[model samples]
Target chain A: MDVILNFIAENLPMITILTLATFVGIEIIAKVPTVLHTPLMSGSNAISGVVVIGAILLIRDAKPDEYLTLIIGFLGIALAMINVVGGFAVTNRMLEMFKKKKK
Target chain B: MERHITDFLYLISIVVFIFGMKGLSSPATARKGNLTAAAGMGLAILIALFSPAEGSFDNHIWIIAGMVVGSAIGLVSAKRVAMTKMPEMVSLFNGLGGATAMLIGFIELKNYQPAVISTVKSLLSNGEAANLMNGEVFSSIFALIIGAVSFSGSLIAWGKLNGSLRDNIKLPAPQIVNLVTLTAIIALSVMIMNGEEMNFALLLILTVLGLFYGVAFVSPIGGGDMPVVISLLNSFTGVGAAVAGLIYGNNIMIIGGILVGASGTILTVLMCEAMNRSLISVIIGGLGSSGSSSGSDREEVVKEATPADLAIQLKYSERVVIVPGYGLAVAQAQHVCHELEQSLEAEGVDVKYAIHPVAGRMPGHMNVLLAESDVDYDKLMELEPANDAFNNTDVVLVIGANDVVNPAAKTDTGSPIYGMPILDVEQAKNVIVFKRSMSTGYAGIQNPLFFGERTKMLFGDAKASLGKLKEELNNA
Candidate 1:
């Protein structure tokens, strides 16, 4: 009801930012051709690893009695870590293969 | 003041991410771009962890344990994985992102459990708790559902890639079941949004159904469609993370997630065009699964050539194009393929690599393989330009590639790959293919280029054949 409406009104700025970001993303990606697609996919996947920030935010808010929350937070951090670390590592490895020849 | 600093860092990270993606668009700067984006993520994590306005970690052991274990998994797996196994690894990483977001939603729910229960019970009694059904609550639930689907769907994709899953989980009218499950999720979500009374059990049902929806969505897909499925699942992870970010008021999270979501979506659309198939037809799966267009109409006499013969023709040719596909990756033949190019180059023959969009297990897979072999970046030509080059080309050497060069894509409307954007190898002056057998490609579509008048089939393992061919050309 009014709560939902107020929530939307308060977050209108974030929503607008997200929409604009998506358009910008589409514009940038449209310029990348097929040969660069794999790197593009892996690189963007690495970027979304920003969710580790969300994991940290939730974990810090947890109290001692909220064990389930604590454990979920830890696991969430671990998964986000994997996405961030593995994604960047893999993308780098793939990108290294695309180096210009020295000669 | 501390919060302001942290918010400022998030803004900078967003900019870095955009610049990183821009750098990745070109081959020369891609590695630097990846490192830059990684630095951005690292800064964002540091700010969130230490900012005084944000909640601080009380248990050092738990947080440290998560970081150490997660970093070990990421570092070890990424280094040790072979280039051929890149697709499943990408799927695994994407799945983890989705799973992380899902768990965060669950953690948020744990914090709100008592209040949620009381509010729902109050709503059942027609009280004022309906106001509790706000955006955060909706976003948390959205994260829960979307994250579950992305996680489970990626696992299935991994299994399919590794061949653990025996077949597509085909039941009669899976489309109906998929439709029903989707409708149920929407109906339940709306009910919760409208503040209809519900329980944790109802939420549990929704979670299970969401997971089921993922399984159903991808279970029927196999073969050439795997790339599209992987890209779709990748976008699902991004969407899940974006919703979770909405709940947490994390601006960088939203920006990063949207970028990923939008890129994945665009990639899928581009792939559909490369295959000349609509998105709807792609979702139906079983595509190109007609079982390798093989053993059909062998009336034409297929010419054969040995490495010695190929050496003679390529050594004298003025222009040569080499098209490599999944077979090249499977046989680990890129090094030799590059050597062959260098040998041909020494003879003053213009040698270039023709790359088809879906040539390997993933999009742009051949580029990675060729580039790894230290082939010059300028030598790789994409399908359209490569096709145009074929008209003036003296010879096209195909290494373990079939689908991309099949002339049926252009001439035979009755073929499964009739409309696919194949490399115009048939238009070249001479064609020589290296393979282990007359086997059809992953699409099970037979390549007419194999049997065309000018084609010379040199049957052997791609690596062995390329090695022998390189040796022959070197000596000549």
Candidate 2:
């Protein structure tokens, strides 16, 4: 019981915050109009980029003793960077589809 | 103490993200999605500051500068970007998720090595092996390889969707190579688990192999299968987040990731169903191949009709219904379509738009494009509602839409898009199709709407054709 309590105490803050955020997000999702869904989904994906940011920070902050953590952080940052750049690139490409011929 | 603040902000950001997504689900509330997402992101950054991780204002100054510059470019481009390119925009969005996953994973891996070794040394001196294992080593290394694959795979999907990657060209023998590389990656993953005596060389080889597999895996898929690919990539992003959450012991990441993965999977299946294709076929498929190539390239099939001829029919008709498709978007003819509707309404003819669910690349795409042209929201009826209006209408004017109005859906079983629900434009008394030429839809199948007895083909640019008809309508 003491061990479980200690475990919960250490990680409780991040957990509670994330849970609340998720609840709120779900609430908003429930009300979303049909026509706006695709764009909304796309935008959400863009915002979820916090994961990349987190990974990069983790890498930069890695203690010399934590080699595995360092490697994982680097991997996360790299992938997230790709997502950010490629996402923007793909979005630009998509927007081009809408360019009208100027008469 | 600082952790509380981080927790509050992270939770707030996640909620905001959800709300933004919800608002985007419907066209009626789409405008709000952008704001909601932005707020969520703002909250997320704020939360990140209070995290257990150390942060100095100086280090973040560069990030702030980058945001400002990025925002300027994003704002300008978003404003200037045409609605027709929305699918590509969606593809790009999916790419971001994949890329982010890969980056985070990589960062995690790179950071773990030294942390593990030091912890191990400390444990050895103190004779505590378990203490070193629980800290960061395993999680970080695992994240790196997974993240790399996600990043490369997403870019390939984006390329395929944007036409930078062609599905028409099947890379033969690549499938076998992909299989072999995948097997090797699995083996490497096992090798990675063999203590923290870091093998950088093996990891590098594995990354290259995974990269090659990612490209080959996504290359053979045609442009038509992009939506499903995007959905799959979305799931991958979710999984990445979940993994990241696990590494950091963040519960929100786990929950959010699971939800995203589940929803994205469902969405992928729905999109596949919409295209009348299976997930397996899409993943390992090539369109514009085995299907109907008989009439697709036939030049003599193009039928030209003047606006005067269409005007004659419209002048006599009591009711007219306009069905818009991707072609209208391509021509930027929504304004013209609205103009045509207004003129028809002025002449005592009832004008309504029959909107298909998946018409014009995305759901409610036609609605947004038409709305931009000042078309009335009430006049635009959904597939079921508009189908009712079609029965009573005298003339069905299908502008720049093919398969949606095709009679072949009713008769052709051999066609890939046979069972898909389509607007029964052919059933109308008089049907006129304004088009550039006889072209297949996204499914790459010829529409039999052209061959319909009542259907008359008016071949030309959709916008120009609509403008000409508008001119004739005014004269009439």
Candidate 3:
């Protein structure tokens, strides 16, 4: 308990930014008319796929005793990779149609 | 040595990402925006993989293997995915994201030094040692629980949407169970907060239970309610990512996670408005099976119109409104619908599409369908504007859309969708409904709107009907 509070007290600024970002994100998302809501969902979903970076970073720092971390990191890498590659690919497929409208 | 340069690169990537999102909002620049976002992602990943801080990855082959296997699966499935199955694809892909986040937290729990005095003799008094374990513990465990829920819950939703789950699995008093499970998780969090030694063993067990908790949470939700469920689970993955971001203190991950979480939540709110239901009611979920609404059982006379007759209706109409529903998605008639719209427009008849907020599977389901068929974004109208346009619309050609255009949603107090907002196609001068059968919508309630004097029903396959109309109109 004390450790958490102390950490929060130290990183208060970063925590505040995260909190603020969440609210600001909601405001921006709410402004998106429902017409584009599906793309919005998929686009943001692609963003969540960014966790692959965290997995890669973890693998780079793996210690000898961190065998479980290694296995989990392997799985994370694979899964997150799917999200990143598939999400971007699908969203791009949908978005390209919109560009055709311009022509 | 690489940390400073990598951080600078990360900064550049984040700036580009922000610009990409801004450009994504409009149709004209959306493709460019998607490419720009991909470039930023490329920059971020290149730094992480090739120029990461600290020690380099030891197992190059395993990393490459994971990448290859995952890419093959994602690419093949995405390529083979039909437009009709896009909802399931989105749900399943989002689940993978959640599962990955959960695994990161899982393996992270192993990084904690074993809880023994002999093993940690040097850290027996070291505040730094305790702080390291305590600091990451909360976020780590938190991500495990939520991500597990998202993974399992989304898989179940995908099954249901694809017709693999035929029945809405009923759980008696699910709210009670959901409440109990939630409270237990909170108590568990409090334990972590108060420094209960942070056991990985207990968290692993809790994660298993959390997986079940997701199934428990979603199974009771009725069939018609899957859109909200899918959206909510999509947000759950984002929240999981957000927690993962905190563990690594990565700015782009943090920003990305928050962006997804907030956007999904807003989309859920919009869905609630479109359904004319409260968020609480939707979450409670099992009410869809109540089967309690009492009304007319006798079949009413429906005015049937043939394709040639419908073509004639379109030829003379001054303003035409096209309401695309889920059936349109199933029939894959969006291309044909757009073809018909153009034929009408060239003849100087103004044509627009009416899109209910919850019309198809997702908020933008109808739009994507129409856009894929190259329908201009300017022609798509929302609920309010659609209803407004209907007032002056000479004919509303409802293609496989039933519940959204049903008048009972407004006038019939006993209707299941009463108090729900609906497209007032009932107000249009002439309403032509195209559907497969006289059956009710997913709501299962017989729509009196079908029996209304001004409404005419065209029964057949939506795509074929549109094909015939397109052919006839083109020849004219």
Question: Sorted on TM-score, highest at the top, how do the candidates line up?
Answer: 1, 3, 2
lDDT of 3 at B455: 91
Tell me, by lDDT, which candidate is best.
Answer: 1
lDDT of 1 by residue, B118-204 (tens): 321121221344533656667877888888888888888888877687374665676788899999998877765555444666667
Candidate 1: tens digits of C-alpha lDDT, residues A22-64: 8988888787767788888888887777777778777676666
Better candidate by lDDT, 1 or 2: 1
Better-scoring candidate (TM-score), 1 or 3:
1
> lDDT of each structure?
0.79, 0.60, 0.76
- TM-score top scorer: 1
TM-score of each: 0.90, 0.79, 0.89
Task: Give per-residue lDDT, candidate 1, residue B340.
Answer: 82
Against the correct fold, how does model 2 do in TM-score?
A: 0.79
Could you give candidate 3's per-residue lDDT for residues B308-413 as a string of tens digits?
Answer: 8778778888999999999999999988888888889998999998898888777788888888898988898988888777879899989988878777777777
Q: Could you list the iRMS of every candidate?
A: 2.9, 6.5, 2.8
Alpha carbon lDDT of residue B125, candidate 2? 19
- DockQ for every model, please: 0.62, 0.20, 0.59
DockQ of 3: 0.59
Model 2: per-residue lDDT, tens digit, B5-103? 666666676666666566556554444655665566555545543355543222343334444444454455455556676666655545555555555
